[model samples]
Target: MLANSSIDNAASQAKTMFGEELIWLFIFGDLCTFTLFFFIFGHARTNNSVLYHASQAKLNVHFGSINTLLLLSSSWFVVRAASAARKGLIQKCTRALAGAFILGAGFAVFKIIEYIDKANAGISFSTNDFFLFYYLLTGLHFIHLLTGLSLIAYFIYNFRANGITRQNHATFESGAIFWHMVDLLWIVIFPLLYLLP
Candidate 1:
């Protein structure tokens, strides 16, 4: 009984330090999955250097660069949002989250335009080994971006309604953490798919 009580107390302390258990679990799982995918992509690229390089050259570096910038800026906004929330600056936090969401939307628009161009040019996942990795990796990252946008929107709405307080700051922090992960994944994806010659 004493051991059980100690364990329970430790778990409670852990929760306090980690913000939320479920969010940590999800982040860990997603990171592991992305790490595996990245490893596979690297191995494949090594085996098909010429194909990968050639196909990579066909990608629009300008668009990829712009998207990277957008995501990085959006991540900054997310961080600012969380910081503002911690300070109980509801209006500042809401504006920061909104900015992040708008930047994420711009990223989606640019990605769609790039996809349309690729389709018009007859390039797709089945085009080649490089294109396959490119599509799979970037497509996955794009889905995450869309999800992050939704999370940001939800945060915005919640902030405007109830606002973030010390009691509920964990919820805001969780959203910010997820948004940073999405941005970090893109930072890796952009270099691998667009500029890693």
Candidate 2:
């Protein structure tokens, strides 16, 4: 009961945690779409557990694990950037944004390398059902990550030009929200794809 009250206090304290309502709506819509995608993948896997298990074995858990860490670190930097921005600390915000960008970009680089390795081994989306879903899911996620990185770059550009003003604070927060959604989606995807038995 005591822990529950502590959690409630923290939640109430963060009442202003959300940014624009439109961004939240868009995120909700995307999450809904992703839910359907995951459901389809689960259904397909259930129908062919043997093939799914074999194809899943082809994936490199190490790469997935490393990429997961990269994204989580990147999200942390984004949180710091948002915090620094709220505090009107321009230099700290800029550094945090840069750190976030680099870490997010690293995830992309590793993903590309993973794809190349699969190509070298003659695996393609057309190889099988599992491979198809893998490519489709990760590809869509890659697109979202790229979008998040672009937003980070945009936030950095604004900071360079405007030096962290109240006017742009909400915008930066919106970007952070989107970046977090990207990270959250991957958190689900990584385990669903890499670690699931």
Candidate 3:
């Protein structure tokens, strides 16, 4: 009975920490998808190490580094915002969300420029297997970032439009969770695509 009670309490805490079960389900499914993609990329790299390493050399590590910093900063802001929301500090939460959105936007712009630079250099989707995976992984991650940005924007707008209150704080928590998910995904993607040997 004691063991069952302890397990139930831990489960309750997890549910409370992560918010809605639906979102957790979505995150879990998305993570599984990314894991599958990671396996495929690793298998391909093992099979064609020479081509992979050569193509990786063509990628601009500078852009990747800058984007990494941006995402890390934005993720920090998201953590701040979520913490602020928990404290019922709506103003602080809004400001942090704004910071996150701006940094995330900067990441998107840099990514676009990187894509353009590659195109100008005659790199295209059909360039080779490495380039193909590069585009696919980064492009999909970019889409996820955009979605998180949109959620942040909406939360900010609703706060400003409706005036600050604790009523919708749970809603803000949901969005913040998604933003962190995107950030964590990028953390894995950065080293995998840019720094992996």
Clashing pairs in 2: none
lDDT of 2 by residue, 65-97 (tens): 999999999999999998877667778998999
Query: Lowest-lDDT window of 10 residues in candidate 3?
Result: 1-10
Candidate 2, run of 10 with poorest lDDT? 1-10
Per-residue CA lDDT of candidate 1, range 1-197, in tens? 11344345444643676356778789899889989998999999999899888888889999999999999999999888866765567898889889999999999999999999999999989999888888888898888888888888888887677755443566667777888889888888889888886
- Candidate 2 colliding pairs, count: 0
Candidate 3, residue 186: how far the Cα is off, in Å: 1.2
Per-residue lDDT tens digits for candidate 3, residues 1-197, read: 11344345434654667556677788899899999989999999999999998998888889999999999899999889877665556688889999999999999999999999999999987999988888988999999999999998998898767744433555666677777788888888888888888
Better model by lDDT: candidate 2 vs candidate 3: 2
Clashing pairs in 3: none
Candidate 1 deviant stretches above 4 angstroms:
1-18, 166-168
- Alpha-carbon local distance difference test for all models: 0.82, 0.88, 0.82
lDDT at 2, model 3: 19
